[model samples]
Target: MAAPLTDAGEFESWLNDRLDSLEVDREVYGVYILGILQEEESDEEKEDALQGILSAFLDEDTMEDVCKQIIKQWTECCSRSAAKRDAEDAEVQAIASMIEKQAQIVVKQKEVSEESKKRKEALLAQYANVTDEEDEAEEEEQTSGNNFTGNDKSLFKNTNVEEVLNRQKQKRDQAREDAQKKKEMDKMQREKDKLAKQDRKEKEKKRTQKGERKR
Candidate 1:
């Protein structure tokens, strides 16, 4: 069965304290105790295992007499480990800060790129509008030029346009004069016909009165 996990903080603190108090020979006992702490099957077993390991170290006269040397060596090892941990933590923080700065720069670059794209799009739209207007104006000019060409062609269609126009004006004047003379002649003819009818009636009445006088 696996041993219960130790809290890193608690274990580091306990190890630091034990290392500070250890004598040279007591270090062997401390190492054994740490091993037992790592391997004990249960939390309850760890205390008993630590006592057993300590008892084995104290029984030996050589370790018991070298307590001061053990303490110095243990303290030095623990200090080295602490320094290494501090350096690693500093490195991690530095890398994290670099990553954050890079991310911020990327975000700013994207924003600038987007703004540039928008400006370019606006300019493109303006350019397109201008091009469209120019095309429309060109088309209108072409249409007007075509209309002028058609009118010019029509004006030149009559080969003797100037002579024909003069002739038409003369004919129109002659027709007007003729029409006026005809209207005057028709009026005179109507008056003569009315007088002839009156004369005929008067002669017929005289002839009838003479005939009655003779009868």
Candidate 2:
């Protein structure tokens, strides 16, 4: 009997963490991905494939890409295998149905994992804005420095620090979001410039080659 498929989230994290180690070969890693998805694969084959995958996973990006690829193939395999077979088979039919359900479960797990990842990144990115607000609040308090004077209970009665801080926070958060937007725009521009430069170089090289042939 083939082994059951592994959890997508756990497998994804495991691969990505290994990629952080900086020694995995992409070709070998690809093979390992295939090997792992082949349930009922022999123990020897599994160990050999894992050894390669374990070697160096320095590219989180690559791992993520491979995660999708693996899941895609695994789902297909499960679906194809799940087709009802003939010849004496309540148990067999049940097993096939279970594999089909497992395929659906794995796909859902992938969706949930991607959503959770986006939420985590958004929270982390927003953390800088929270820090910015705290710093601003501290600076305001420092600069204001005890101007209230002689207010045992008569000089001031309408002070809402919470409301003020919240307003300030809202402004700071908006500013931070705007800055992030600009930064992404700038990064995209840089990539475009890089691509244009490469294209220009390729054209120049082709023109030089053509001229040399004529000479």
Candidate 3:
């Protein structure tokens, strides 16, 4: 008598404990629990208990189908969440790379501007020096006394003026040439800088692509 009572109480208590630990699929467990509780207190009760236990624990054919469905849905949800997180991380990384590229461009542009300013200052200084030299030469010619024959006087005057004009023209031409050379050199340097920057950008792009491939 005690052994039969113990067996009945054991099944009932086990069912109650497992039902309390439920998270989902509550309807299935509810139907089984009710079926067990309503069974007669005889061999019928034992048979019902066995049937309910088989339904709850022996999940080989019918319950295996439900578990497969639950696992499939759970796997899909986890995969979708992981993919969304990965996409967001990639977007943030792209934005950060763009910001770095723009910063490099700005730095290169500032360096070019500074170089141009320095070149202009150098040209202005050279022009000022040439102008001062010309003024000094003109003053010396005007201070020289007139002591010569008529033809000699006329030749000296015309030659002196021509020499001064020619010297001034030569100075102007030299200044122009120097400024032009500086501008051309600066242009070439800027082009080289641009090329180097482009190379760096290409390398960074390759690195980013490699990282994505690894992922």
Clashes of each: 9, 7, 0
Ranking by lDDT: 1, 2, 3
In terms of lDDT, the poorest run of 10 residues in model 1 is 65-74
What TM-score would each prediction reach against the true structure?
A: 0.41, 0.27, 0.39
Runs in model 1 with CA error above 4 Å?
1-30, 33-65, 148-215
Which digits, one per residue and each the tens of the lDDT, describe model 3 over residues 28-135? 664554343434344445354545454655555754453343333333444665676778899999999999999999999999999999999999999999999988
Name every residue pair that clashes in candidate 1: 22-71, 23-67, 23-70, 23-71, 24-67, 24-69, 24-70, 24-71, 25-66
lDDT (C-alpha, whole model) for all candidates: 0.67, 0.65, 0.63
- Could you give candidate 1's per-residue lDDT for residues 99-189 as a string of tens digits? 9999999999999999999999999999999999999999878867765456665665554688799899999999999999999999999
TM-score leader = 1
Model 2 off-target regions past 4 Å? 1-159
* Winning candidate number (lDDT): 1
Q: Please write out the lDDT profile of model 2 over residues 128-185, one tens digit for every residue.
A: 8898999998876765565443452233333556568889999999999999999999
What's the CA RMSD for each of the models?
12.1, 52.2, 45.0
